[model samples]
Target: FGKENPLKANEWVRTFGATAGDPEGARLNLWAPAEARSAGGKSEIGYWGMELGRMLVESEQMPVCLINGAVGGTRIDQHQRNVADPEDVRTIYGRLLWRVRAAGLTHGIRAILWHQGENDQGADGPTGGFGYETYEKYFVSLAGDWKRDYPNVQRYYAFQIWPKSCAMGVNGSDNRLRDVQRRLPRLFSNLTVIATLGVKPPGGCHFPAAGYAQFAGYLHPLMRQQLYGHARTASEFPGLQRAYFVSQRRDEVVLEFDQPMQWSDSLMNQFFLAGQSGLVQSGAVEGNRVILKLREPAAGTSITYLDSARWNPENLLIGVNGLAALTFCDVPIDEQ
Candidate 1:
């Protein structure tokens, strides 16, 4: 996911300033235009944040506000805090902080929907050697700064960038960054990773309106469960539990998921093996596990999914709830 530039009329409107219909006296007051009406009589439909807010307002009958801070074509370093002056508007992080404070929302933030990293995934330039360790360090510092500033913020919904959307050519470093992103939840207690593997209209660095709407559809329900305690019976978000060889020979590997899985298509060619194996000849679902049959004897010491960052829109391994599996790279294959 990326910034929705030139925001559509009703998709998202100014929450602060006189334009939002706040008291003209307080020009800086920020308010959620939950029922905001344009000059026309019809109510406005939305894409990502708006759609999610609409669902929350309709289902829970509560007001939801989205404070968007995403800036297109920005690297992780650009978002680093200006420790010398946290409110220095010249810096990206400082500017966002200044805006939030100006709107009297320093403490009102409940969650953050973060969709970035496209700019940082480039094969060269700023992202040339920006592997997992560098990104993790920068992001950790960013998160710490946020927690210090916005103490009440509870959740961080980070969107894992797809290889197809990388601004530069795909490489192992890009997928390595993705692997780090998908593992963010483990690094922070309040963070959760949202996979972008199977999202539609996926060729661009930024998704179109329809693709974002689809993303909102997948996100709203999980938000309901996480923030509202709506669905507590089972895991609403699914992830890879473990991957291991089915036998010592390693001819077959099994990818176990936290939930039952289903494939959208026959081809699971996205998987690759390292070590002695040639390739993943074929794969199939067996209950909660994906059995990958190697063309040769199973001798690989490691396995990787979404190998080479191939973009397959229709073919995906998804959970029963329809959430796609997060791309994992060089996951160690456990011996039986």
Candidate 2:
């Protein structure tokens, strides 16, 4: 999401059909710090792809080809294919499909880095009534198409958008969309969601060069863990597994994570007791769980963390893999 001009070229990286003239999808030389340039270096350089590809090539000691068919400000529904001709070149989905087929990568794709939902979330662009349920439906359809099209695709890395700076007039919609994105892994076996809350330069809807580079940094290890079966710590997302009260003190709730995690003390106010007057007064990291001390009793109240669409925290609760916790909304608390 950064870079006005192309950077140095990486010989190990290549692109297929970045221009209209290249119908055969020739493997053209790409220019960037570590990524294949989109539109033959005529478009903005996405550092995430560039750096991630560089890491992959360095780790595997082989060349990697990137086929990017992303259209900016497109809704998830726009990516849906026409059933009559799924690969119709006139449509967005078809164009991507056409490129994949033309490049002979219909069965060779290792992973898909899905970073979208700005427009669909009613933030940066028109939503057209694309709400939570509609998004889930369209995403499911798209995933189905991918499953059928890219039969060999191993990983589906979904990026959960940071709604704070992105929200325009629809804060609820933004948060809901993010929640849906965070829950995508539960819907698909190969899908994993990456949190974007911790990325730096979080001023505008699009991040700066360093932010996109951080995105790549977060993705590389996870990709290695999934694609190469490498056991890398901090590669796994520190997602919330459950929330419950550990003892008779109804003022405190324990958030259990899926993996061991670490946190900064500055995020006490980030946790919210839904419908409750006071915020989380304090928090402690213990092994894989976090104990949040609330100003009021949290009984019968739902819990949320970093869920506000306009709240951007400088500090984050990161996992062993250096990834932040996926933002959650209205996560019900259980009495344990």
Candidate 3:
């Protein structure tokens, strides 16, 4: 409970089948940013509360409390009170969820989304500061606390403290923080830390409103696709060889298989064009599919697959058949 707009809870009615009220039998509490929580004042939750709300509505998932307890200058240490069980909580700072099972809030609270540490980035000690060893213990300690109370609860999605302006890895804060953050998934079977590694904007520790919106943009559409996209078998999302955003009209964005691509891991939202002017996002789906609609000629334009981070200079998707399905140029098929 740090300060300002603690939470902004709401109930997003499922669009299709479910009439009004909580869809799929879940009573998502939609915890609004703590400051706005006139009902409950717990604002130090972190922007994740806001982010989670956006994802729920965007992903069009079940009901959610979507609480926001972020304080302007708060750190992870502040979440101790939120821990579902006070007796179970054990961090020096004390930031965590109260054992809802013990407090008697809801029967099945799926999981908790913890995100913090912008403030503690510089605090010195064990795990790079909290004693590298202790840093590791904090995670187990926090999870153990929760597991003990909510016995059935397991899935956890915590943030690996964002890139710090504190020291950028010199004192090993960034590195150690990351090391500690990455260990969660390994330490706990149901735990996962959504990688914000390359997702952060330039000089931004937390995404601004615009940045936040874009992040939310994907959840809804992707969730909708998931309805039709979820595979019935183990081989649902097969590996595809290419990904990118098309930038030109008629730019044939062909996804060549690393090995024939019978199917893909997911209908890749791939398409990106990078050339003399760096890179830009591709446009909508076309006839059979949509390649980024090019407003300009592709004569000199260079198209890249996926994000700038996704690169294959050799175009491995090309295969022994050579750059067969590859579309390196925006050239029109000429019939002389």
Candidate 4:
């Protein structure tokens, strides 16, 4: 079995056979074998797969089987098969399909979990400092390919990439990548960007065991509400909807959000306004909106939450569901 012309589905099944099926009931394969170490280890020490499986069994009375297919240090391009060369079995995407076919789960895929993009943001990355537009194109193409192959797959969830820190000072382009990931949901309705706010990666870009466990905790409730049609039991996470200049107070700007925010002294500190002079100034949170005091006028000023440029450990803006406000910026005040 090699990267190129790897084993086919039938061949894999004939050799390894189906990974022992879940005797409890049905199974939900949790793919991502490549990055298993990052999510814990072979036993899934701190992987979210364990948490997901347990939640499904206890809360929803559903049996699940996690099938991992992730490979470490791989870029999105590696996981994608060439649309023109669909028959090529060299790509990781082709290999993943083989695994799915071997498991006889061509139609059992509930959701696809993606936690990648670090490699793409590397200094000498394949894309060479890929921007948001380019990243969007590649991702959309990948999602389209996956859907074309597995029509039964319901939703696709991706993690916003971890940023550069003192421990791992490799790629400084992570913020750009994170921005691209944050806006992916707008482009693809079926995709959900799992918020990685408040998650502190240990050293390097990978989250430690505890961090992985915490990520699972964040994901469980979301899946419970989104996939199972259960009502949100926790506080909602605040997200920006739009921003505009106050007609009466031209120097002031109002920011609207999708959900209400739990305002606090610390939370208000996370909000910032920027203009040509840089870091304009922030005001107060009045009801479900935030007011920004522009240095001069609302001409070229923009408001951002959690300073989308760098990793700030102190940034905290809790939303409705006990989740932190997403990293956002570049909200034009003139736009309604």
- Candidate of highest TM-score: 2
Off by over 4 Å in 1: 1-14, 17-46, 123-128, 233-237, 263-265, 275-278
Give the Å error, residue 1, model 1: 14
Query: Per-residue error at 123 for model 3, in Å?
Result: 4.4
lDDT of 1 at 72: 62
Error of 4 at 136 (Å): 0.6
lDDT of 1 by residue, 15-72 (tens): 4322222233223344545222232212222357666766677777776666555556
Writing each residue's lDDT as its tens digit, candidate 3 over 29-121 gives 233222222322332223434554556655555554433323445444443433444533342222123223222543454565565555555
| Local distance difference test values of all predictions, in order | 0.68, 0.72, 0.38, 0.58
- Worst-scoring 10-residue span by lDDT in model 3: 13-22
User: On residues 1-336, what C-alpha lDDT tens digit does candidate 2 reach at each position?
Assistant: 333434556877766544333333322332323343445433223566777778889997888876666777667877887999986666777766776786677999878889888777663323546455578888899888888999998889898887643554264667667778888888898898988777776645777777888888888888778888788655766788889987777888999999878767777767777734346788788899898887766556577776554355566778876767888877788877
- Sorted by lDDT, highest first, which candidate order results? 2, 1, 4, 3
Lowest lDDT block of 10, candidate 2: 25-34
lDDT tens per residue, model 4, 1-336: 112321112111111111222221112233432222221222121245554555555777655555555666766767777666653455566545655675677787777888877666645446565544366777888888778877888777787655542222243355556667777888877776766666654324666656666666767777777777889775334567678888654677777776665655445445555523343355666667766665565545566655434445655665655676666655556643
User: Residue 333 of candidate 2: its Cα lDDT?
Assistant: 87
Cα displacement (angstroms), candidate 1, residue 144, comes to: 1.1
Off by over 4 Å in 2: 1-4, 19-45, 123-130, 247-249, 275-277
lDDT of 4: 0.58
Q: For model 1, what is the C-alpha lDDT against the true structure? A: 0.68
TM-score of each: 0.82, 0.86, 0.46, 0.75
Query: Cα lDDT of model 3 overall?
Result: 0.38
